[model samples]
Target: MSDDAPVKADLDEIRGLLSVMPKADEAARDAARAREGQLTKPPGALGRLETLAEWVATWQGRTPPRIERPRVAVFAGNHGVAYKGVSAYPIAVTAQMVANFQAGGAAVNQLCAANDAELRVYEMALDHPTADFTDGPAMTEEECATAMAYGMMAVEEGIDILCLGEMGIGNSTSAAALAHALFGGKAQDWTGPGTGVTGSTMELKIQVVDEAVTRHLPEMTDSFDALRRLGGHELAAIAGAILAARVGRVPVILDGYACTAAASILYRADPHALDHCIVGHLSAEPSHRRLCEAIGKQPLLDFGMRLGEGSGAAVALGIVKSAVACHSGMATFAEAGVSDKD
Candidate 1:
């Protein structure tokens, strides 16, 4: 091999990270539960809030889980398939939305501000969209691997939690295709009216998903192939970030249908792969509920959101912060001189 030969990225490296993925800290979870019992409240009255604290402790591997450095990453990419008239908006909207995000003019900006989380937008070669999978593989193995690598690098040291989101026009079609290929359902089951596609456009979206999966299914062989064959750069990046967050002991909140579809790839690779993450919300997209069931994670919110660029996850981060505040700040029964539950 020549020294100047292009260094190639391999999915095997991602699989290696998965094999070494860390599980939640059960000890931390137990400690959080013990503290929960000590809080001056009726047992189970706080409901999911109690479990929310425990979940944070479990995934962060620390008692009194902190949300001080929550982060939201929105990846934007163009898809070659956008040329197929699958979306109501033009492909140029992808880059334009990234600019709006950069200028703090998007919905995600306000949501992140409300949650006190840092918002970072990563553009995944907006000028170089993946090949349309209906025609061929959306990305070569190396291209997909590199995008995933870009996502992994989004995980910086000391982030308390990561919120995954995306911003590619027509990517709902990509998400549907990835889910259809990964989970073995009919194309219509995963396809939805993305970006307000209705009537004939919706039908075209489903056709695109079906044809893409049919063209690539024989060679897919595994979940990673499903991603590379049917996913966009931003989707591949989300998978990368999810894996990196697991390795770094950061809990994750995945946003909407597209983001969760990306994470589902890792879940298929290993059922335990998503142990450290949660779905941020129930998307208005029909397939999202089905996708969430397939991954065994319930949505944290049901605002009927479908905006995609991590907005839902960013909002859910506020809920996580609230859980941390109550868990860490509320006085215990002993401190408050209150009677314990009989």
Candidate 2:
């Protein structure tokens, strides 16, 4: 975007951009605050909704912020680690779900339709998954960079907000490994019953994450390095989409554990990297709560969701829409002929 032709990005370029990322527009944020005080509603009655309006304006760089064209981009991929039986579902389900998305049969599709947002599902080389990290890096620098670039392309022109989500067998395992490597924790602390695994399967998944992180810990020179070694194509794509959203002046809503973990790569690289993003909801996958706490982001909702596929983010878009409506559509105390607070 204005991120200087974001249609392309190599790993090194992404790393370079981290240091020069733009910040939310304080002028816009201040303007939103001023408008909130002038509204007829009592002070602080709207709670987080008031903050949400300001957040939208701050990131969108405008006082009268609106989300006329929100889009949900769901990236689907196959994880080679799934071959080791990490998730209860088979890897083939990833592609099948992508097709279901195209047919408007997935939960995300319905949520997008219900919320009046566009839905785009990207299949990130599902025919060729990355090599299992147990053996080596999940993707080479070039492959990972290409996936990022592909993700950047997902941000179509004129979208007001972008919601990020993912679908990939064993991706929760990858998300857990990413957390473990990036945040320094026991693999079990980050692991959960993704896709509803039980007992031995959960134990195996935790062991795999530990092994992957241990193998790559020394090689992880930076966040990008850890990402290339541990993140899947869909995960890399989510990171790219977030960077693109920030550069393009579009606020973002991240859905569930996998999407947030993917974004954590950028956050770890630069502390201010995710200034334009908000967590859509609290995921029930355990690490989701811990990871949100680690990043200091209070999710907008807590419906105990772990469905991924952009469902939660799409639902959260409704709240953002309401915030926009109330902030921009409501009359001021002066316009309403209401007495001002003493």
lDDT of each: 0.90, 0.91
Query: Alpha-carbon error at 15 in model 2, in Å?
Result: 1.1
Clashes found in each candidate (C-alpha, N, C closer than 3 A): 0, 1
Give the clashing pairs for model 2: 1-6
* Model 1 residue-pair collision total: 0
Tens-place lDDT per residue, model 2, 110-157, is: 899899999988888888888999999999998888788888888888
Q: What digit string (tens of lDDT, one per residue) describes model 1 on residues 46-99? A: 888888889999989999888889899998988999999999999999989988
Q: Mind sharing the TM-score for model 1?
A: 0.97
Error of 2 at 275 (Å): 0.9
Report how far off residue 263 is in candidate 1 (Å). 0.5
